[model samples]
Target: MSNGRKNSMQRVSDSPRLLRLGAGASPARDKQWFCNPGSGAWPPPTIPGRIMMMNPDQNSDPLFDFADADDYQRLRDLLAAAGFLDESVLEAIGINDLPDLASDHPLLLDRTAGGSALHTLIRLFLMEMPVEADTFAQAIRPMAADSWLQAGLVRRHGSQVTAALKLLPFRNLILAFDLPALLQTPQRSRYVMGIGGSTITLSQLTIRRHCRQTLDLGCGCGVHAFLAAPHSSRVAAVDLNPRAVRLAAFNARLNNISNVDCLEGDFFGPVAERQFDLIISNPPFVISPESRFIYRDAGLEADSVCRRIARQAPAFLTEGGFCQILCNWAEKDGGDWGQQLAQWFGGSNCDVWVMRSESLSPAAYGSKWIRHTEFSDGETGFSQRFHQWLDYYERLGIASFGAGLITMRRRSNGTNWFCADESPERMIGPCGEDVARGFALRDFLETVQEDAALLACRLRFSPDLRLEQQFTPSAQGWQVSGSTIQLARGLAFQGNSDTFMANLMIHCDGKRTLQELLPDMAAALKADPARLAPLVCQLIRKLVEQGFLLPAGQENES
Candidate 1:
């Protein structure tokens, strides 16, 4: 509602605002916009279900294709017999190239890039049991009955799906998939892993009251950037690897999304002074001595990527903007991750919600990164990479590490900070909106508390809202109402609150009576006296802001 934000949103939301996003617009500080390339509109993916993540064919046209269970299985068997399914090819060739593969494992070197990549797709995903008893059906299983595969192939060689998939090599991605369906895959599949989940999670939690610009730092293959393109006037997608930038661009083209501007740069440098309404990232959290391949490792800095992301976000978020991230951190000699997060807020009225999804010791962490390189087929080098991870952790004195999802919101209040670990039990569906509400509500609470001491407070939770009864004392100065009180129907105030919050506080100067406060209250709200009087009276029926008309004092005071 701020003037600056209003103008920014208006300018960015042009009907033709869906062009390549101006990734450099700093939404954290200045309200001004930079480059604006007006593409008609975002080519949003038409989803068949409420769950967009499972829908891979999220485009006007889809280039990647999937096969039916029986036929796809037959293709897999043929490829395996031809050596295309071997791990050796996966390790050496890199999965993206397909057309050149013509040897015995033609799928490995002679097939089109998209189709060749499909083989790696299978190699990366976990195998689902065949519906029948026999695990080996002489061919590859489609891995899923998902529609993303059958929805029609993604554009193959060029702009159109059929056009892009002009050749047999490309057609395989459409006709014969390599990986299992994401929806059908088991909980944790080695074959299907990457930054997809993190980006999706962050996207759900982003606050969009109309974002002028947005940025996806460390945008691997540009999936996150693509998602952000729809809501933002302009979007900037950045990654360190040239190949990643190319792939991200390719993905954008495939998705028919023109608003995302893929850039090559490290965090915050390319987007200097550009503030945004939202910033999201699934940065490299896997702690490694060296950030090899730029795909997984966060480098020798040990949580440096996460820390930098946290530290830099506030600088770019507008007064009411927000940033969300997923990261992994080292737990040093009893140091709690929550404490570190608290410090990261930098006194901004920021609320941080983190869900500790998993924790692993130094050895376990090392092995996970080691396995990512398994496709390389160099046993000795794999061992070396594994040892490097262990050495990095040991030398840094890391005992255990934790990984989690985080969302931060910049509030109107100056420099207030909140930190807590979210319950994994409640991390269902998508938690983006829940996280955003936490920040927005926290901001509202801070503003409200300034007018009244919640010494005696109660909360009557609504069924429609996802909330819990909880209270916290801020350095023993102020305490919030507990879930029990908030979930109840009545207010147990110290005294009857006979007036609106602003009315009560203003007239609390001790000279004005109820009659005297009515005029100011009506004027502030611009409401009629008849309607206003009863509303103010009903507030007193329970305890309102002014502590003069309620039940026994301290009824539920902690």
Candidate 2:
């Protein structure tokens, strides 16, 4: 207590007693307020408010999800005008008879606790399309021509086909519409959790550093737009579906982002030209068995997604800008996927980096799509759809489908190609951005045919730590062990290049603890222990996490 008092008095003697502001007056209003009345001294710290908070979370409460009667009516009016619902059809289909509708739309039409683009009323209406017929499932198709529905209970549901298209999961439906503004965000699992190879590839591969103006083609829910808006000065995301466009706009507003402008258009036909540092897309590349979701299942025949992206991306890209995309393409007539993509450049001076990131057997790919639409487990039509896919694959002689990161830079200099096509033996996160560097891209692409990018990493031990045990190559995977208890928690190290890996392994001596070996490592690696501390700490942490190193006892560090 005496020592504490002494410290307190010392603090008081060293500190200044600043002037006070009057009640309700900001301290900033009085410039001379900082002066101590007793000591007439300056404060110790120069930069005030340095420790203050800058960024604040906007939402503190949960947002409302259900629509009230008044809000519902307002939404109903808006949707009606947006071509979502037809009054006459609503009457005919008996929207008032909610219980009856629930029987048909077993998964939907319950008018439950929530309402959304995929709610009971919306899904049922969207599925039933031009006229929802209770009698014929075929006639219930929103896109089926009138003549196909010469039956009873053919009730018209939506004034416009786009609304119905947005919700339809049927194989025969057309994907000519967009998502509405309300549902386009990561807040919905339909956008965020739904991400696959296509989304990840685009996110990682596309270069964002130097871009000023960028375009996100077919920006569903504006996922890419959200990413691009922060990195670039201006980004324009365009989607063919009106609903998707509105959803994209809604996403922008929700994030308080103003730089992204969402537009509705079909392909590059609606996109403005002659300006963009980069263009990115994950277009509807799935060669569809039917035209159902135009956003995903490309209707155009034969490498349509790849061809369209290749054809349109060139128009908007700046002189030195690049177009990066993830596309599904066929290996046709003994033609390599790389060669096919190269031909798409049409002898231009553009450099292409096509790394076949993934490959799947026709059956596996076909089954996945079938399950997505619920066709695989559905009653009767699903089997037909599955067989139809098999027939399509057989007819095309498609050994397997390939998907990967594709980057094209508009440079008039030398053209270089990189191919890292094989699936990795063990890949955790991503290699797309790394693969995009011009040198890396070209090197990987050129060397990919041999399938070695799959196992490219060279494992080694740390330079600053001792190798406790060494194991030579055996019949199994890498059978090597080393102890790095003091300097590091683990024995593992990373070497991207072979020479570095070899050099690191050579330095892992069994004799020295990390502290004892510090001087030698400092001399050899040209950095002192203090200088190398941070790097060593990080490497040690990673090694500990991987079980190559163990944590030290508390008494050891002291």
Candidate 3:
């Protein structure tokens, strides 16, 4: 490890002592010391100091309380009956996309002005706007308004009732979480974030194979855990923020998900002895100078939190298990960022694949992150944070910040391989199966390193593969000037190709081995089979890696 990384680890190690001081102490005292009022210390104190004592009767909290499982089920059924699902709400709101921030609520409310039950529900829950008591009562007919108020779903104010939390209908599951506006307050440090870009990316990147046990490290509002519930026999969701843990547990109950257990602790400390078949984390990975938010910032310096997770996650994973994390890491000046990442997995016994989506210069990175939370802060505050972050990056010699998904699969028996590359520009939908297939393909490629072995394997083009040809008008009746091949969905990887490669792909129907196809290919090109064989093998390897082509038996895997 580098000296910077060592220092970061030491800082993290020293945090526990501060936390030990608050052991067996009252929650009020803990909160008072950890969150010093008017101190203006961004995250108030150290990372460990943010750990709050979880209430024994967390479920009974007015904001989180639901009468019972049946009440939860009733609320779900009522929403469904009122057309309050993701698709229905989107259609009713005259928007194709769901509202991500509180700023989008005005448009949603305007579009959902119709006085129907669905519109009323949308205004009440989705828009987080207060509705008249009679309108709210009429909207939830079967269930009385008092029931809703008693369950803490809504709070009455004069003649109107407002939802206490934001209820999002996501992927057929309803997740209740802290409102977006909460992030602007002093309590923002512990505010639980709802669905966002990182959450969606990690969900799509995760390998969805059914497992005996799964872990959602730094799970906020239990979204990942709920997504993993049906596929996993049991899931454990852990976070350091007590409020996040409480809300995640509340979300599980609201969604009627019994297999998930939400716990409050830092990193893997809560589940030290437990092993999981799958582990997914979208931890506090912003590489910032200040730790202002538990959901976005880890108090450790640089990208130490992500590095620590990469180094320690393997021990908690079972053989053949997988751990996927969405994170940001520093790119040092004149250094290979990929190599730096590879070192994090040294002796981890895991095959690692890093799909870096984007990298931004230190100035750009600092500005973007500072603006995310400090947008409400006037110009002076924003400028101060931006300069402070830039100075921190300069002092640490950071050139840029790279953000993306890191997927690791444990393999105890063989030599682990590390693959790092830029990810596809866009993903159409869930690509969990593609992730699993990528791992399998890498394993196959490692075994068939020899040309002879590769030639013996049969291959087929992916069903979603597409070929595009570009032509110029000046070139005699639309003659092809360039051609490219791409996938229609999933990772959506694309690459430049030629007529010959396209024809070769047409022949890859899993009916003929590469050795058998080489003769035909060479004959079409009027070339020697020996020369064409090497070129074809290389192309095939590239196609398989990009997921445009799959080995025979793997066609049906995804």
Candidate 4:
């Protein structure tokens, strides 16, 4: 990283606070007033009386209590009618991004000032700002505002009312969870996290094929379980945090989804011996020094939680089932990260694919996660915590941390393969189909390991494939100097190739075997096919692995 970027990161890491609240909200007051229900610290020593207590039993808790199912349905409909779904809320706020804990709230509030009911909802729930009672009441008309207040969705103080919980409209469903500010406090260890980048990334990476059963292991607020509900006959959402379980159950009811069973237990203990066709988890895999938060820390040693999940997941997966996990793993100095990760899945009876996204040094990793939870602590406190984390890493002999998605498929009979590669920086859209295709392609490659077998099988270029050439000004006018072959969508893998390779890619039309195409390829290169066969086979295998080419008649398999 450049010095400028490093300085920027340092500033973010050392910042005193994350949330910048609007009027009537103070960080000190929030810290003093807010407390987890079952932490034996409820009713803070100095209570401002502005915030109400959240019941330990979520069923009795106002936030989870839905006296009337229609009321929740009406709430969902009201928000949807006002165009408060998915990314539309971002567009309505005149911003292309969702507001986070570090977002400038006052500026966002000013942008949405004096706007429609949608804007009111945005300011109240999304921005976590206090709204005028009259404005809030008007925004939620037809459905009595008292219902919202009674349900503990919002708390009133004099004429102003603030949302007690966050209502996130994501993927056409309204998910309820604790406010983002709660995440910054140690007291709120049981905080149920709302939608985050990891949640969305795991959802996109998950295979969407219809399944007999789906398990959302470590399911927070049931986002993955809900996403898997439509295609799955039954979905089981398990979490160690009771608060998360309650919120997930409440969300399922709020969305009128009856197929998801939300349970609270550690890891796979809740559904022991029960097999699932698909298992997805965005587990608490952060390799932190302390287990302060349930949603982020696993209370285990360095990366042990992730390793445990990988080792145990295959036992719960039915034959040919997939287990996809988003996690962080520790990397030792001068050690191979891939080989270490492969050891986690050794003798697990599964084919593992590790798509590493990024690796960061100990300092960088410590700064990033510390900035996330301890941002509320001032610079001095942040510095202390940073050094403490560094000490922990040093004691553990850790050099860096690797963050990415690990996908494993339960293979009963065939020789299982372990494939590891750097993932593409960006995905065009949902790449679940691409993930399935990748496994199938890997399997195909395994079957045709020999040169003769690979050449005997006909292959075709991916329909989304595109080849581009760049010309340099040479004595010979416009001679092609370089070229690249790329997939236009789905994983969007792209790499440089020469003229011979470009021509070879275009010729894979599923009409001719590699043996047949070799003659034309060799003629273009003015070389004998006998001598060029091995080189051609090597290039074709690479193309197939990168998804630029597919075996004939297997491109469209689910």
Query: Could you tell me every candidate's TM-score relative to the true structure?
Result: 0.50, 0.49, 0.85, 0.87
TM-score of 2: 0.49
Q: Write the per-residue lDDT of candidate 3 for residues 241-340, one digit (tens) a residue.
A: 6666667766776676666767666667767778999999877777777766666677788888888889889999999999998778888877788998
Candidate 1 — which residues are off by over 4 angstroms?
A: 1-195, 347-351, 375-387, 444-452, 455-458, 464-558
Global CA lDDT computed for model 2:
0.45
lDDT of 2 at 550: 28
Candidate number that wins on lDDT, 1 or 4: 4
lDDT of 1 by residue, 70-154 (tens): 3334444544453443343444454543422333344433332333333333322212111221222212344332332342322
Model 4 spans with C-alpha error above 4 angstroms: 1-63, 99-107, 184-186
Which run of 10 residues does model 3 get worst, by summed lDDT? 13-22
C-alpha-based local distance difference test score of model 3: 0.75
The TM-score-based order of candidates, best leading, equals 4, 3, 1, 2
Q: Judged by TM-score, which candidate is best?
A: 4
The per-residue C-alpha lDDT of model 1 at residue 447 equals 50
- Candidate 2 local Cα displacement, residue 435, angstroms: 3.3
Q: What is the lDDT of candidate 4?
A: 0.76
Q: Comparing 2 and 3 by TM-score, which wins?
A: 3
Q: What lDDT does each candidate get?
A: 0.46, 0.45, 0.75, 0.76
Model 3 lDDT, residue 210, Cα: 95
